[model samples]
Target: MSDAVRKIIHIDMDAFYASVEQRDDPSLRGRPVVVAWRGARSVVCAASYEARKFGVRSAMPAVRAERLCPDAVFVPPDFVRYKAVSRQVREIFLRHTDLVEPLSLDEAYLDATAPKIESPSATATAQAIRAQIREETRLTASAGVAPNKFIAKIASDWNKPDGLFVVKPAQVEAFLTPLPVGKIPGVGKVMQGKLQALGIATVGDLRAHPLEELQARFGSFGAALYRRARGIDERPVQPDQPVQQISAEDTFERDLPLGEFDDAIRRLAEKTWLSTRKTERVGRTVVLKLKTAQFRILTRSHTPETPPASLQEFTEIALALRERVDLPPSTRYRLVGVGLGNFRERDEVVEQAGVFGE
Candidate 1:
């Protein structure tokens, strides 16, 4: 609404895991590589550009990736090392501005409207940060600089691998109009299909729809879509944001019988609990996801007034979710996932201590 422009930059590391593997091992240089174990259960964590030529992609099964590229090299993932490298890259970002939000280990958003320099231009900050990442971490990062997060995130991917793109404030609408609605964040497969069914094919088409009509059809998310279509996102870049969710999942080599599903759920719950050590916040909901042998997915979730305080409590909540699923006994499962959600601010909880004490 305010015509003021905010400089935002998005940076994504190039084939992060695979590149790190190659950077550490000269023997793997310039080769088609998939960072994952060779098994039906394992998914590709990252694929080198060479592997992408063969259609290998992250989250794709390693077996399928191998089928796509017979000579593709499979490497086990080392998330510990990846996280360490990510910290180093983040330190590089901190040197530029404090308004840094990490999307994942290899990607982040930076607000450079007020940089610690004589000139606080977004493009200059992006270039300097990228140069620093390459010089310090030996990794190349593609960067997109724009007036807002919506444009910056898309611009970052415009140039793949080691590239830099910028979308000036004046160019926002022209840049967004021709792009498909599917390109907007949160518009996934089902949402895109819905938009297509309504003759809203492009961002321009979405812009043409009455905001009230969109709200009538899709609720609050439709309002977000309207903003994205207009290249208007007002979310500020956040620094050191607290964790919102914790989850753990496992893909089975073969469809496991319902008899063994309980064990898998227990393991995942334990893993999820272990992963929560980094977060001070507690979750008020538990969710269980199951993917059948046919890949038909089902999710069951529950939210309690109080969060689970221990691993045993969390496991029990997960078991309750398992009881809610009424799949056929003969139906086998390919994956099982456990998650906790609906986090509350730790500080808010701390502040409520006196009230609860009363």
Candidate 2:
């Protein structure tokens, strides 16, 4: 193992939801598929490659997707099945290394420096993982192998469905040079515009900019930009990271006054409670989040001496927290959210007194 370098692999499922739908139904294979609920207000959860050719995309309104691909087949998302498949994929990853960081149900970063499997190299490990996923799930995945996470993430996308790309440490700088600044993580459209204004259109241009000048121009983010331009990122793939919060939110088709939020809050609370039940940790704080029609965000939270004992109790607490909102009675809200925070692992709470002798 090289002391100064780490081997990271990013694996991403191709058109996850749409692919799953295609796999389960023979009739849907080789067809443009859009995964989303059928409703005027519904947005696409995923779009198959066939749909992409017709300009359909994830998060696009379903009606627009229908316009883009009139022959497209629409399938609602099946999160329960998705979660099961995700667990199967995670099990496969754990067979390689425990150092797996999941970004979503269909994508993860795996530190393959010391894989459990006796692979000849990180590239080989990535190949084997991709092969296993195909053999086991009848699904395809794209992989990127690199010296670090960020580059691995970018490399993973260089190839489309069922492809692999590798970036050796020596090739990092060369690979990043001509890449647009927007390709760098965290440099979104707005940031790209700001950098473009300064004649920093590519990683090479960003590299040439003086560190002091970048600092002055972009504040702390400037330092990050400088490092990224040089193909440097030190983040590690951490598994079982602590949960800070769990929340569920929704945007309504039409904004409604505060008095009409009861049903929304209850629905969000039920969603949040379902999510919390997936973990052994218990959250002591119940939070109510609201976004006004004008886009102003407000939150109210309460921490009781004990965590809510049941989903009903959780919903009750979330509903009660709504009364704490001091916004004008006539204020209309476009979004409502329910959340749980200040979590403690069940075992941690059980052993606290013994460990501290308290």
Candidate 3:
């Protein structure tokens, strides 16, 4: 929206986990693959493009995915290897620009207003990045280049799986006008339904609504909708954002009572602990999250005088926090999660302790 423009590129890996599995095993190159743990309660982490044709998708129950594609090869996720590959891809990004913001192991946003390499334009930089990824990792990536982060993120998906799309500054309005409202980030199914009820199905339709009316109807999000509908995003690409929290959650096939949640809690805690190990900071607060069958949500947290010293200590604290739940005894929960927060670097923790004369 500002006359001063910024160049942002969004890069996303193609079926990351499933692609990694296929890349490592030549026998799986052209076949449908589903990455997931082995259990009735497990959910799909990633589904290859081939499996997607059979209606299998990430987060779907493994049992349902199996039913959808009985012949699909099922493999467990190897996050350690995935992380290593992610680091390799990140190094490729750094060669072009330092303003790289990793969204996850498979996707990132890069500000290429001034690239390190002598490239004529952002599009060229993106092409080189993708080519390097394929040559080095044998993996494909999709890239989108636009004047701003919001539009760039949408452009990235236009040409997926080893493709590139670009949106110039002058083309922003024309590019956004006919897009469905659901195409905008944060406008999920529920929001889409609400907009549909108001006869607003596309970005053009949303533009017809007055700002005041949109604000009155959808609260603060209405303002965001108004700007995004016009392809006006002013957010900058940040590279040094700190980790605020680390967590892992799972949904059960059937609701289970609180008394039957011990195993779930332990598993989630272990998963959360694994994630924390990837960072340099340690978490001092342990949190337990739950969702009842009736859709009610609850959270309980504990922050001890000292941060958890080990995975066993972190798990114990999370499990003990479960007893703090005050819901009805008969309430059945459909989801459970464990989290660690209030993170601090080891050096900072030591400095604080010394300052407090502890």
Candidate 4:
């Protein structure tokens, strides 16, 4: 890393899945929309800004989200469609910079230190990207421009849903000072509580602590925190991140017996299946994970000589694995997850099988 500052732009789509639905279906516009499978065991995938005002949020249980906003329209997730739109956005990103790191289908970080498209500044580059996203996709995006990845990510959300913000290199220290410690990446509620116990509520308060003390308190994470408090992140944006594993899990509102897990298993299998389709690689294993009411965790997996050819085969394999569980029939489960792992590129998997397959 050089002392010279880098220009990074973080672009985050606004309520991506829900907004896509609204864009394609005019009636969904201006109406609160929750994108998710409609079931007690289902979770919200994305909520439109209109839905957010009513307290609906992504990953929240669908049952609870319904209670929060009874009038919200619930639509099942369509990852295939979302992934198509995502590819369009990715094309738009590559037009400006090759150094684009896609964090997900809806958000990415672009290293515009030297953009392919000549721009007056990184701020202009971010603005141009946002505008292009709107013009091309008919969806909105928020952008943050800064010297580093962490700051850029945080700034992106400062003014969200079709907004743009910039933090100059000289302004980094002051920009982080008054910010809440929780605003720093990875500082979740548990970490915030730990920091508050030490009277560290803001970045300024955290900065007052000595590095040795912080390291002693938090180990490697604490040392990272010390640097974050000083706005000294040096991490680079990573592009073309390979697929390792894809899974979806849910914690039931109430524990269920193993016999009653069929529906949940099927739903989670579909989610993992849809997610895997977005990647070029093939997942070769089926994994069934269970957490007992007593908090005991168990996992079962099988890697077929060939990857499960269809969702039906994958879901059936997951259900069959449940029969392998040796727990007492009386035992109840609090959580269940379905996954596809042992990811290998399509060509690699095909070559190993001695059969040409997609």
Candidate 5:
């Protein structure tokens, strides 16, 4: 909101998951690689730049990616090792500024307007972080430095793998006007279609529309779109914000029978627990999600005062939720998912409970 500009930097790892695989395996270096098991039901976690050249990408089914890149080497995902590397990278970031907000394991925003060290500018801070990642992790990171989060985030992707781009306060409009609407965050396939239908296909096009008209179409999100299109984002770099929940879900390739539900829920609960453990947080609720063969979704949740802290307790809650479902034996389902919620720091649980009379 102020005319005085701030220095924000977004650092994104270069094809992070696939890069990890290539970094570890001598044979995978400089090769087209896909990180996924070979199966029709399997989804790609990441694809190397070489693999991406053949139109492979994350979340695309491995079966389709294989058809796209016939010679691509498939490697199983090892999230455990990936997280380890991510932690190392985080430490590197902390050495510069505590205003680091991790978007995921692979990307983060750093507010270095006034960093711990007297860096001349945000660009220098970004260069240091990128260089540290390369030296310590043997991987590359792309960085964008700008006056705000929205501009910086978009600039980070402009140059591609292992590149850096900058967006100065004076040049924000020039950098954003020619970009497509989809390049703005939150403008996915459906939103893009909506904008396209309104004859607003580019950032400049959106800017031409009246704020009132945009608001009528998109509610509060319209205002956000207007700001982002103009390369303005006031969101703070929230590194200290506590995580509220952790969840994992799956969309089944085909509907599964009720008899098969128990095993599926068990597996999902285990997966959720494993993921939550990585963040070192405990949850008070267990959630089970089900989707019918016809795409009807149902969710069941339980908040036990004493949340399950072990695999045995995890399985117990999941089985209990499964029993509550009234689907017939022949009824089929398309998806099953499990999750944990109402999380808090382990050390603060006692105080949290007392405040809530738990």
Candidate 6:
């Protein structure tokens, strides 16, 4: 594709999981709702705007959300119901464009440059989609329209909760200039602090630094930052993107010391390995993820010269990865995840493995 203009829209549902709970139960309406299982190890899947007022947020520990909002109703996630609703919303998108890239159950990116429906502009297409979603699902959605994916994603959140924001091609630089570097995707708290330490606070400040200097400081990610600072993103919106990895994770009923997690790791590794069998792609890397009782996350990954050949090999590899955890033995963990990643086509794996006569 050339440097031709593109029409992109990012649609995000308003408090999706919590909103679904409120919509389904009359008692939950107008009340603070936290969507999560009730347990010491449970985490919030979503929080209603009402609950958000009390500082409750998604991914926060359920116990903490309770402390934040004493009266909030806690509901476990019903993925079946959420999937049903998500399908309806996706059907609506299909009517407008086949270039629909779903980000999750409640969000997607639509390329409306050549839409199925005749719209005067991308902004109009976004309004139509949002309206149809509200009419069919009785749920509100926010949208952002821009010349590219990253800008569209950011614009969609500018005026959130049933709002729409637009960033025209001519205005992308101006739109980004005064925005905080943290507002750029992938620039999280740690990255933002590092950038600010260098007196790079806003997007303009990031643009001021030479690319060589940025790469020296932050490596390849710095190159990404350089492009984003200039409001340039060339990634195409890909629909039906392939599965990148397969994994299973669980939170412990009680926090357990590192040595006590071997059984958990074996079970999760078996589960993950079985999932990978369903795909033709082979996974070469085994990842072990641990979440401390205090909520810090740590992961250890190893890519062997060849993919694990059987369930036994996969399990042993996952078990051995546990030794890489340098946390104090007394440091209990609340969660464990086993994953197979770095997936490659079977033919490619075989071709690479042939080089070592394996």
Q: What's the lDDT for residue 48 in model 1?
A: 96
Candidate 6 per-residue C-alpha lDDT over 1-358 given as tens digits, one digit per residue, 9 for 90 to 100: 5324999999999999899999999899999999887876456778999999999987677889999899999987776788789889999999999998887778899999989999999999999999999999999999999999999999999998899999999999899999999888878666777888999999999999999999998899989999999988988989877568789787887899998878678767766764565455689999999999998999999998899997789889888998898988799999999999998988988999898985
Steric clash pairs (candidate 3): none
What's the lDDT for residue 312 in model 6? 81
The local distance difference test score of model 2 is 0.86
Candidate 4 TM-score over all chains jointly: 0.79
Provide C-alpha RMSD values for all models, in order: 7.2, 6.7, 5.2, 4.8, 6.1, 8.4
Per-residue C-alpha lDDT of model 4 across residues 1-358, encoded as one tens digit per residue: 5523699999999999999999999999999999987876667789999999989988677889999999999998787799899999999999999999887788899999989999999999998998899999899999999999889999999998799999999998899999999998778776788999999999999999999999999999999999999888787878888777899887887899999979889889877876776676789999999999998999999998899998789999999999899999999999999999999988888798886443
**Per-residue lDDT of model 1, residues 217-259, tens digit only:** 9999989888888888888888888677888778777788667
Name every residue pair that clashes in candidate 5.
Answer: none
Q: TM-scores of all models?
A: 0.76, 0.74, 0.78, 0.79, 0.76, 0.75
Top TM-score model: 4
Winner by lDDT: 4
Better of 1 and 3 by TM-score: 3
lDDT digits (tens) for residues 48-119 of candidate 2: 999999999876778899999999999977777887888888899999999998876788999999899899
For residues 200-249, write the lDDT of model 3, one tens digit per residue: 99999999999999999888999999989888888888996778899988
Go through the candidates in order and give each one's C-alpha lDDT: 0.84, 0.86, 0.88, 0.89, 0.83, 0.88
- Going through the candidates in the order shown, the clash numbers are 0, 0, 0, 0, 0, 0
State which candidate, 2 or 5, has the greater TM-score: 5
Off by over 4 Å in 2: 1-3, 245-358
Q: After superposition, how far is residue 142 of candidate 5 from its true place, in Å?
A: 0.5
Off by over 4 Å in 1: 1-3, 246-286, 289-320, 325-338, 341-358
Relative to the unseen true structure, what is the Cα RMSD of model 2? 6.7
Model 5: residues >4 Å from true position, as ranges? 1-4, 246-340, 344-358
Error of 6 at 171 (Å): 0.9
Which candidate model has the greater lDDT, 2 or 3? 3
